[model samples]
Target: MARQLDLVDFIVGLPMPVAASPQANPLDLLPRRPKAWERMVAHVPAEDVRISISTTWTRVVVEQLREDGCGDQLRANGSIVSHDVPPGLIWPEPCRLILMTATSAARIHKRWCLEEAPGTGLTNTFRFARQQHADRAAVSQQLRLLGEGQS
Candidate 1:
């Protein structure tokens, strides 16, 4: 028959150019930078850290759902055309939209940047990753040296 869509998700998926589409969601400005995107990065409780969505426009979806009053038209002859990227929409960053007409669902994955993670004192995520790599290298070197010396 026809597919169903949630208004919230539909609104969130709309592209920029579409007149009926959603706004330029500030969430894409995740983890802010230069103190400009600070507000978007949220402080998850008891985590000692912050989290944000991607700034990259990887996941962007177009709307195909048409509403005539309270009901929405889901399928175009029970085919996938019911889920199309509302024509003439373009996002600033690179993005991809996936429409699975069989399920009538749209999924988006976009890129983003963060402001700071220092608020929780565990903001050294990158530093920690680098340090771990260095430490592993040192350990590997030590093990190789010990093996060579013993052999």
Candidate 2:
């Protein structure tokens, strides 16, 4: 039998680890950030177009872009980009919202593919999903509530 009084401890002990799925390398899934320049090019699709990118932090990718003379090209093309947009949002330009959305969707799909790349430890999403379900079930059993129905 289980008691409601044990809820605190059960809640505290949340996220029990399963033995089958060992901790994956943090580098195993190096999340790819969307290429702002390519996105702008595809969205605008012209011989010469100016685009402004706003971001919070100065990522290595951004630095590489500056080093690769993209800054000079953008300047010649009369485009200025800065990392100033709010979190979880594309560039704040109203005209580019739809294109940005499509680009964002594509970026997500690409990242998913990279995470599940062949020969990587993170390849088996099915196995990981099953392990997650099993872990959740074990936790639920350990924290079974008395006099309450479970879905």
Candidate 3:
């Protein structure tokens, strides 16, 4: 039997799929940069250190489970769904809905310039940070070596 969806089952204004059909390339879902991207990049230093962290969105189900004697208590559970996870699987709860979204990879990448591991990549920000932490002398040595077109 089909279960009737309640008000709590709805996630208001959830985004529509990027394409008309499931067979469409998933990359179509990737967020696009704004027209001001270059101007925005100009403000961010090229030498700035960048990192990627928890960048997945999730949804949860919360229910008010009433015990025999105790007052109503909420039991909550959730699953991350922003990745390439297959959808339409049965959630244990009837009214599973997205309560909040976590940081997304597109948002993170838009905010920070992600590059390959520092020294080998186009930027040496991490190497600079490491050297700075090690000693001022180490930084000077690195700068001198780089000045000589070595490192």
lDDT values of the candidates?
Answer: 0.26, 0.27, 0.28
- Model 2, 112: alpha-carbon shift in Å? 13
Residue 78 displacement in candidate 3 (angstroms): 49
**Maximum-lDDT candidate:** 3
Q: Give candidate 2's whole-model lDDT.
A: 0.27
Candidate with the greatest TM-score versus the true structure: 3
lDDT (Cα, 0-100) at 111 in candidate 3: 33
138 in model 1: Cα distance from truth in Å?
0.8
Task: List the candidates ranked by lDDT, beginning with the highest.
Answer: 3, 2, 1
lDDT of 1 by residue, 21-57 (tens): 4334333422223232122223211122222122231
lDDT of 3: 0.28
Cα error, candidate 1, residue 41 (Å): 46
For model 3, residues 23-140, the per-residue Cα lDDT tens digits are 3222222333333422332333323323212113122222111122222212233221122222332222112121111233223223332233333222322211222123344434
Two-way lDDT contest, 1 vs 3, winner? 3
Model 2: per-residue lDDT, tens digit, 1-151? 7756588888877996766856343222222334554444443321122111222222222211222123212222334354433432321222221111222222322323211112212211111221212234322232232102221
